[model samples]
Target: MGQHESNTKLIWQVFGFLSIVTIVEVILGIIKPHGLHFTNFLGTSLLNWIFIILTLVKAAGIMWYFMHMNHERKNFVNSIILPLIILIPYLVTLLLIEGHYIHEVMGSYINWKY
Candidate 1:
């Protein structure tokens, strides 16, 4: 049937898009270009920032298309997404702050042999 064919096409398209995003993530992780790897942004390496952003993008795409959020009412979608939008940044900020504090404290007391 035409509907079945269309569904199949859509499935393939989603699969392809997700696959491409994953491949890009993997390649970037492996290669870790020196410029990106060395640069710091928001207390994290540029590479780490890229990974986080790409992960969010992939998650949003999956939720919107695969999980059928796109068909839901605007308010329903906003209700679900708003918490995540707020939480992710909050969590990231906490992580960076705590990590920096730990690094500073450890550096002050710990001696390196190397």
Candidate 2:
């Protein structure tokens, strides 16, 4: 019974943390401060980068807590995280390259037509 109660409290804590993070994301998206929106980093706006980073934080938190990754062995955690370290960058690079090519080719037409 004590263990169950402790687990329930932890679950609520995780829930509260996730809720707060999401609320922050929503508020930032709505507010879109000029400084963050206008500044560019790596071809994307700072605001967009913030959204991406916050989203990644939320994902890691979910995986660590809700999926019980925290209870897993160190080797198991490394096994999952290490591959993503390589793959996520590779995939993002692909997206950026393809998106840039497509934008160069089709952006004018799409904007004018629309």
Give the clash count for each candidate. Answer: 0, 0
Lowest-scoring 10 consecutive residues by lDDT in candidate 1? 1-10
lDDT of 2 by residue, 7-106 (tens): 8788898889989999999999888998998897776678877887788788899999989999899999999999988987687668767877897899
**Largest lDDT belongs to which candidate?**
1
TM-score of every candidate relative to the true structure: 0.82, 0.83
Q: Candidate 1 — which residues are off by over 4 angstroms?
A: 1-6, 105-114
lDDT of 1 by residue, 1-114 (tens): 664435678778888998999999999988889999889888988998889888998999899899989889999999999999999999988988998898788987888331
Worst 10 residues of 2 by lDDT: 1-10
> Which residue pairs in candidate 2 collide?
none
